[model samples]
Target: MRLLATAAVITLSSIAVAPALAQTMPVAPSVLPDGTLLDVTATGKTTRVPDLATIRAGVVTQAATAAAALSDNANRMSAVLSALKQAGIQPRDIATANVSLQPQYRYEDNKPPVITGYQATNNVSIRFRNIAKSGAILDALVAQGANQIDGPNLSLDQPDAALDEARVDAVKRAQARAQLYAKAAGLSVSRILTIAEGGEIAGPPPPMPVYRMAAAKAADTQVMPGESDVTVTITVRFLLK
Candidate 1:
């Protein structure tokens, strides 16, 4: 119908450049259809600020004996835990990620390896609910013997609701596209033959970029959480009459 065509065009225009994210999905029907099979695919996008951040921080110590290395690491680890608590990191937010003690070896050609010392490493995964204070917390952790800091894996604490919104948008986009193709071919959309959900970014994004300001009034680590993109794509097969 004319109204259907107009609505389809309106929907298409609302999502400018969205066509670049999708194409006609290739599909074959199991049974012969009385009408034509028109396939359409579309993507939906949404932006959200990250609500959770995860960091891996720990200490590394080396000593001539394994016992000595373990003892030193434990003492340093205690200070690190205290610092985390002082930074308002809840006990539930702190988890031991890794703890290991390995022997240091010196290797030479045509000779057996020699034991040099023992290396101890203890790392904890720290989840920060207050992202703004993470920079200051890292500084405090460093002051308390945390030598290795790995992340700030930023993510949405509750992504299910956001993902559902994207799904609705994607379905709307696909439906509009189907109408467009049917109208162009002098046919009417009769029914939806198939609905298939596509891939999505379901996990935390890569670690954020962090920096340490030295020339400023307070030399401390800075954490920046820019906007993250949540996308969903779907393919719909329409029976055109």
Candidate 2:
């Protein structure tokens, strides 16, 4: 489990914060017979290729009236959904992210803004487990009246295991550093007194623009999710004899 609280307290505050279900007590060294205390902070990271992709596909339409704009958006969005299903996307991986209707206005030099037409947008967020086929699916979506394509944000499908591995690496590095310090001080390492961890830092790549079919009709869209780094940092207290 990830350590939410940095200081390990046996008892939590009377008014504990939500989401942090449990508190871990810091270990206290029972014996301190002639020893020096040392604190070591170390960070470890691991790189892995992202296994999942996220894309926002949407239909945008403008008409004279709100009802007409909405109606047109709904019809085109329905076709987009059908195209997604036809491309082997699962129902669970597809979700409606946004639906909005706003008035398009034209601004004049010396007069109040004039309402031109109503613009309707319906967007769906799709998770592609198969990164290889994500590009093709995005192209298909564009062909089916989907004009607004926002992202191809690549990320890991499962990060828990990778994070755990990083934690273990961090602990090992801390131990190694502690040993080095003990040797430098002409003392042997004894035991650990406490261990605290900062928040994990794992971030995906920034969003990339996926071109619509009109501008790039010559070729199929391609997605290249390079790699991401998962890092864990830990501070450990050591006793040296």
Q: Please report, in order, the local distance difference test score of every candidate based on alpha carbons.
A: 0.76, 0.74
Predicted structure 2: lDDT:
0.74
* lDDT string, candidate 1, 11-130, tens digits: 211111122333444556566578777667677667778778889999999999999999999999999999988878999999999999999999999999999999999999999998
For each candidate, give its TM-score against the true structure: 0.81, 0.77
Per-residue error (Å), model 1, residue 149: 0.7
Poorest 10 consecutive residues by lDDT, candidate 1: 9-18
For each predicted model, how many residue pairs clash, with residues at least 3 apart or on different chains? 0, 0
Give one digit per residue, the lDDT tens place, for model 2 in 115-178.
9999999999999999888888888888889999877777677767776777798788888887
List all candidate RMSDs to the true structure.
6.8, 8.1
Instruction: List residue ranges in candidate 1 displaced over 4 A.
Output: 1-30, 202-207, 212-218
Can you give the lDDT of residue 199 in candidate 1? 53
